[model samples]
Target: MNNRYSSNSAGVFTWFRDAAEQGNAYAQFNLALLYKRGKGVQRDDKVAFVWMREAAKQGIAFAQNHLGAMYYNGTGTPPDDSEAVYWFRKSAKQGDASAQQNLGLMYRKGRGVPQSDEMALTWFCRAAEQGVASAQSLLGEAYAQGLGTKRNFPLALAWFRKAALQGDATAQLNLGLMYRRGHGVLQSDTQAVAWYRQAAAQGLAAAQRHLGVAYAEGRGVQVDLERACSWLRRAADQGDVDAQFNMGVMLSNGYGTRKDEAQAFAWYHRAAAAGHMLAQYNLGGMYAHGRGVQRDPAQALVWYRKAADQGAPNAQFNVGVIYANGHGVPKDEARAVAWYRHAAEQGDASAQNNLGVMYANGQGVPQDDAEAVRWYRRAAEQGHPLAQYNLGGMYASGRGVERDPVLSYMWISLAAEAGDETACNNRKLIERKLTREEIGSAQALTRRWRDAHRA
Candidate 1:
C-alpha cells in the first residue's frame, strides 16, 4: 500500500510539474501547494513562492489570495503589508471571499492602508454574504458597536448567530454577550452560559473567564466555587489578567479552596505585573502586611505607586499615608498633601477629609481657615463623618465664615448620628449655646440633608 501511495504521489508531482512548465495556472498553483506542504515534494517556501507568483500573474484569484497570505505571513519572502494588500485587493476584486476578509482585516487594523471602519465593514459584508464565518462575525461586531454603521442589535444578533452556527468561536462569545446584555434577544443568563460553555470548550480564554465569573456569581449556574475556581484557573493559566486577579480573590477568601495566602499573593503578583490596577493595590497591601510574604514597605510602596499612577483612589490614598508616615521612605508632608489631593479630586471621601485636615493644620500648605472650610464642606457634603465634625467646629469658632449656631449644630448633629463619640459630645455642648427655636431649625436642616443624600 505504501509503495502504491508513493507511486501515485510521484505520478501526480510529475504531471503537475509538466503542466506547470507549460504555463497551466491551475497546475502551477497545485505544484506550489505541494511544495509548500511537502505532500509530494520537500516543503520549500522560496520555491513555492516562485510558482505561486507565476499562477498569480496569470490572474488566478485563489493563487493571488494564497500569495497574499504568504506575503502577509512572511512564509517565502519578507513580510510586506503593502504587498499583501496589493495581492489581496486583486483577488478580492475578483469576488474571492477569503481575500475579501483579509483585505477587510488589513483595513480594520490600518496595516498597509489607512484604517477605515467603513471600508472594513464594506468588505466584511461582501465576504459575509459569501458565507465566510469570520467575516460574518466581524460584521456582527460592526453592527453591534456602530463601528461603521448604525448600531443594529437585531442585525448584530443575526450575523452573530449565522457565524456561531458555523462554529466560529468569536461569534459564539459575542452571541453570548448579546444574550447576557439583552441586546436583541431577551436577557438570559442561561443562554449566555450555554454559549460561553461552547466557546470555552473550544479553548477560548475570554469565554473561559466569562464562564468562570458566571459560575462564581451564580449568574446562570448554581454558585459552585469549585467549578468557578477550575474554570478561572484555566483562564488564568492562559494569562487572562482579570482571571488571575479573581483567582487571587478566591484563594485569599477560601471560596473554592483552603485560604492559601501564598497562592493569593502569587496570583496578585502575576496580574499586577500585567498592569492590573486593583491587583497592584492588593499586592501592595500583601507586601505591607506581610501576608504570605515578608514585610517589605519598599515593595509595598512600589506597587502602591503603580496602582496610584493608574488612578486608583484607594492606592493614591495609601500612597499618601505612606509618604505621611515615612513608611520605607522619608516623611514628606508636601508629597503626602499632593497624593491626598489626587485621591480627593476623584471623590474619595476619606482622602477629601484628610486633605481638609491638612489644610486646617497647615501641615503642607499655608494655614488658611477659609480654604480648610471649603475642603471640609466638600467632604462633609459627601457624608464624611470627620469632615462634618471639622466643619461644625469651624462654624462654632467663626473662623471661615460668619458664625451660625444653627449650621454648627446641624453639622455636629450629622457627625454624631454617624457614631462619632467626640461629635456626640460636641453636639450636646453646641446645643446648650443655642435657643430652642435655633435647635429646631438645625434639626429640620439635618432631616432635609439626610433625605437629599439617602443612599
Candidate 2:
C-alpha cells in the first residue's frame, strides 16, 4: 500500500492511492489539505474530512488541529462548534500550542461553550508563558482591563512589551499606544515612536496612522507633513477609514500636493461608505455646499442622516437646518429642534445659541424666556460671543430676569473682550448715556467678576 499523492517519482494519483491504502497519517493529512484547498485535486470537503479523520484518529496532532479548524470554520463539514471544541481539546491535551490558542479563542468568544473569562485567561496564560506572542498580547489586554484578574497596569505593560519585542505587529502598535497615552507606562513619546515605527514597517494600518500623527505633530519626531501624508496614504490605500478621512482632508487642502477635489471626494466617499461618521459629515457638507459635487440638498440630507445616526453633532445640526428650511423635506420645526437639542448636548456652541433662540422664539417649543436664558448662559460660559450678547440683552430688557443695566453692561463688555463687534458698538452707545461714576462702578464690578472667573 502507498500514498498516491506523496509520490516522489511516480504520478500524484498513484502516490495518493498507495498512501490512502497504507494508512500513512502524514500522507493522509497532506492529501486532506490538498483536497480542502483544491490544490492538485478537485475541492472535496467530504474526501478531505474523511482523510483528516483518519489522520486525527492516528493521534497526529497537526491533523487533529487542522481537522478542528475545518470544523470550526465550516470549511469541510457543517459548522459544528462542539465538534471543533472536541478536537481542539484533544489537540490541546497533547500540548499543541496552536490548539491551546484556538481553544482560548473559543472560550473567550463563547463560540462553543458558555463564555468563561477565567478559563480563557488560563489558556492564554499557558500559551503566553510558552512564548506565544499572540497569547502574550491577549494576556496583556486582559490584564489591562482586569478581565479575569485584578487590573494590573505594570503586568500589562510587561506582557505588551514581551509580545511587542517578539515582532507581533498588533502588540507593537498596542504597546506604542500605551506609551504614547501613558495608559500602562510613563508617557514616553520616544518609546511610542520606536514601537510605532516597528509596527508601521510591518504595514499595520493603525500603527501607520499613529505614526503619521506623530510625524505631523513633531511628537518624538520632527514635523514632516510629507512623511505624514505618505504613511497616511499607505493606510488609506488599505481601506482604513480614519486614514482615508485624514488623507482626504490633506488632499482637499493641498497639504503636501496641489489640491485635488476629485481625489479628495473619492476618498471621502470611500470612508463614508465604510461607516465613518466624520467622513459622512464631510461628504454631506460637500453635497450641501457644492464643494466637490453638484449641490444636492437631498443627497446632503441623506449623508447627514447617515452621520446623525452615528451621533455626529455637526451632521445632526446641519440635517436639522435642512429640514427647518425645507431644503430636503417639508419644513419640520419639531425635527429641527430635536437635532438642535442633540448638537447642543454635545457642546456645539452654535447649536446651543440656536437652541436658546428656538426657546425664545417658540419656533418648535413653547416660548419660555427662562429656558432661553438657561441655554444662553450655557453657551455664554463656553465663550459663545453671540450667546453673551443675547444674555446681555436679556438682562437689559428684563426678558428673562430682573432688569439691571449694570449686569447688562458686564455681559456686553465680556462679549466685547471676546471680539463681538456688535457688543462693542452697543457698549459705546450705552457709555454715552450712563453717568461717569455709574459707569465706573459697573466697570469695577465687571473687573471683580472677570477676575473671579479667570475670564
Candidate 3:
C-alpha cells in the first residue's frame, strides 16, 4: 500500500488504516497510540497492542517504552509482572531512562521478578546518572538504608541533592531529614526548613508534618504554634498519621492553641483507627486517664493492645505496667513479665530494668541473679539511671558478677556520683578499703566513657 495524504485525524486514520495494515511502522505506532488512548476511536487495548507490537518490532524506542509502561502498570493489559519486566528490559536496553527507572522499581519491590537489590541499584544508578530525578531519589534511599550498597551517607546525600535540585518533592523531604539529623552533612536546621518548605508547598504530606514540627520546636524558625497547627491540619487532612498524632499532642498539651481534650481525643482516635501505632498508645493513655472522655479502661486496653501487638517499645512497657497494676485487666504479673521481655529484647531500657526486677523477685519468671544482672547491665549502658544504680549495688555485693572489690568500688563510685543513694552508700564503704591508685584508675575510666559519648 502507498502512503496517502489526509486532512484530519479521522481522514488520516482512513489513509493510515491501509498503511498500518501494510506494516508501515510509523503509521502503525500512531494508530496504536490513538487506540490505546481512545482518541478518535472506540478504546480497544487488544487492537492497540497488535499495532504497538508491529511498530516495536521495527526498532521504535518510544513505542517499546510506552508498551512497557502499559504492561508495567496493568493499563489495558492483563496484570503480568514477568511480561511487564520483559517489556521494560527491552526498552531499558535501548537507553530509555524511564524504562531503566521502572525496571529498577520492579526489581526493588520484587514485582514480577525475583528480588534483587543489586540489580535494582544497577538500573537506578544508570537512570540517575542520566539525570532522571525519580531514579536519583530512589537511589538515594537505597544508599541511605544500605539496601544494595555499603551504607554511605555522603553518597546518599549527593543523590538526594541532585533530585532535590530538580524539584523532586520526595527528595526534598529526604534531604531535609539528612540535613536536620546531620546524617551526611553538618546539622543545619535552616537548610532542613528550606527543603521541607519546598516539598510542603508541593503538598507532600510528610514534608508538611516535618515543617510543622520545626515550627513547633522553633528549631530553624521562630516557634509559632499557630503555624505549626495549620501545617499539621493540612497534613492530617491528607491522612498522614504522624501529622494527626502530633496535632493531637499539640491540642492536648495546649501548645499554640487552647487546650481541648475533646478535640485531641478525636484526632488521636482517628489516627489510632488508621493503624498509627504511636497514636494507639496515646489514645490508650487518654482513655485510661479519662482526660478527653469518660473513663473506659476496656477501651484503653484495646488501644494499648493494638500498639503493643505491633511491638512499640513504649506501648509494650505501658501495657506491662497496666497488667501488673490491674488498671484495666486483672493483676497478672505473669502477663506483665511477658510484655516486658518482648520490649526488653528490642532494647527498651525501662523494660529491661523492670524485667530484671521481676527476675530478681521471682515475680513472673524464676528468680536468677545472673539474668537480673544481664538485663540490668543492658539498660545501664544506655544510661537508664535506675538500672545503673541497681547494677552498681549487685556488683558491690557480688550478687551477679564476680566479687572483685576494686571493680565493685569502681562501678559504685561511678553510679554514686550519678545520684544513686545505694551506690553512694556502697562507694563510701569501698572508700575505706581502696588505695588512692585504684580510685584514680576508676575516675579515669569514667572520664573516657563520658568523653566518648558526649554528643
Candidate 4:
C-alpha cells in the first residue's frame, strides 16, 4: 500500500507542476506540499516556499497558514516573526484553525506582536473550539495559570481532558498533574498514574520523571524502587535535570540499585552544572568528604558557593565553616562572619551557635559577650546542645547577662541530658558550689524547662 501510494503521488506530480505553473492556486498548494514533504517530488524547502507563497498570495487560507509556519521556522528563508504573524493573521481571519492557533502563540510569546494574554486567549478559544488538540491544551494552560482570565480549574480540566483524549502528550501530562493535585476534581493518585503512564509511554521526559516519583513514594502503587529507578533513569538519559538529581540521590543511597558513589557524583555533577540547587550542595559535600572522588576542598567551596548564592542556608553555613577553618583558602574570619550571618539570619541553629562562638572569641567582628549570649540563646531555644553548654558557661562566668548560678546550672543540665560529657562534668562542679535549697530550685527549673520544650 505504501509503494502504491508513492507511485500514485508520483503520477500526479507532473499534473500538479503543470497546473501550478499555469497559476492554479489549488495545484500550487498541492505541489508545495509534495515538495515540502518529499512526497512524489524531490524535497526542496525553497521550492515549497515559492509555491506556497504563490498559493497564499492567491488567498488560499491553508496555504497561507503553511507559508506562515515556514517563515516562522526559517524554512527555506531567514526567519521573520513579523512576516509570519502577517500571514497567520490573514489565514486566521479566514477561519483557518491552525493559523488561529499560530497567531495565538505569537501574541502569547510577544513574537512579532505585542504580548497580550487576552488576544492569545481569544485566538486559542477559536482554534480550540474547532477541536485542535494543541490549541485545546494551550487553552487549558491559560485557564490553569490565570493568564487571561481568573483561574478556572474546572474549565482547565475540561480542556485538558478534551486534548488528552485526543492523545496530546502535554495535555496528558497536565491532566495527570490536575488529578494528582486535586485542582478541579477529587484527588486520585490512581487517575494521575493512569494519565502519567499514557504520557510517559509517549516518551515525555517530564511525565517519566513524575511517574518515577510516584512509584518511589508509593502514590497509587506499591513502593517499587526498581521501577522508580527505571523511569527516573529514562528521564535522566533524556537530560531532565530533576531526574538527574534524583538519580544521584538513589544511586548514592543504594535505593533499588547497588551503591555507587562515583555514579552518584557524576549524576550530581550533571544536575549541578544545569543549576540544580540541591545537586550543587550535594556535589559540594562529595568534594569535601572525598566521597567517590579525591578530597578537594577548593572544589567543595566552589560548589557550596553556587548553592549559597541561590539562598541555600546549609550551603551558606558550610561556606562559613570552610572560610573559618581556612580549608583550601586563607583563613578569613571576617568573611566567615559574613557567610555565617547569611545562614544565621535564616534561623539556622548551627550557624547561630557558630556565630556566637565567633563573637565571644573576637575572631570575626569585636568580642562582645552580650552579642554572644544573644546568638547562643537563640540556638539554645531551638534545643541546640552545644549552644546550651556555651550559654551555661557564659552565665556561670558572668561574661554575659547578670551572674546567676541557678540559670547556669539549668542550662548545663539540659546540655548534660543531651550526652555532652563536658556539660556533665561541669554540672557536677556547679552542683558542689550551690546550697541544697538553690540546687533544688535549679532542678525544678530544669524540669519545667524540659517539659515546656519537649519535642
Q: List model 3 lDDT by residue over 229-305, tens digit each.
A: 99999999899998999989999999888999999999999999999998999999999899899999888889989
1-455, model 4: which lDDT tens digit per residue?
A: 23556758877888889999999999999899888888887899999999999999999999999999999999978999999999999999999999999999999999999999999999999999999999999999999999988999999999999999999999999999999999998999999999999999999999999999999999988899999999999999999999999999999999978999999999999999999999999999999999988999999999999999999999999999999999999999999999999999999999999999999999889999999999999999888999999999999999979989999999999999999999999999999999999999999999999999997
Candidate 2 local lDDT, 103-189, one digit each (tens):
888899998878988888888888898899999999998898899889888898899999999999989998988898898788999
User: Which order, best to worst by lDDT?
Assistant: 4, 1, 3, 2
- Candidate 3 Cα deviation (angstroms), residue 417: 14
Candidate 1 lDDT, 1-455, residue by residue in tens: 23555658877888889999999999999899888988778899999999999999999999999999999999989999999999999999999999999999999999999999999999999999999999999999999999878999999999999999999999999999999999999999999999999999999889999999999999988999999999999999999999999999999999988899999999999999999999999999999999988999999999999999999999999999999889999999999999999999999888888888888889888887888898889999999998999999999999888888899999999999999999999998888988999999999999999999998
RMSD of each: 2.9, 2.9, 6.7, 2.4
Write out the backbone clash pairs for model 3: none
Segments of candidate 2 deviating more than 4 angstroms: 1-17, 37-45, 445-455
Residue 192 error for model 4, in Å? Answer: 2.1
Task: Report the Cα lDDT for candidate 2.
Answer: 0.86
96 Cα displacement, candidate 3 (Å) = 1.6
The C-alpha TM-scores of every prediction are 0.91, 0.92, 0.73, 0.92
**Candidate 4 clashing pairs, residues 3+ apart or interchain:** none
Give the number of colliding residue pairs in candidate 4. 0
Q: Between the candidate structures 1 and 2, which one is better when assessed by TM-score?
A: 2
- The per-model lDDT (C-alpha) reads 0.94, 0.86, 0.87, 0.96
Candidate 4's C-alpha runs over 4 A off are 1-4, 8-10, 435-455
lDDT measured at residue 155 in model 3 versus the true structure, 0 to 100: 95
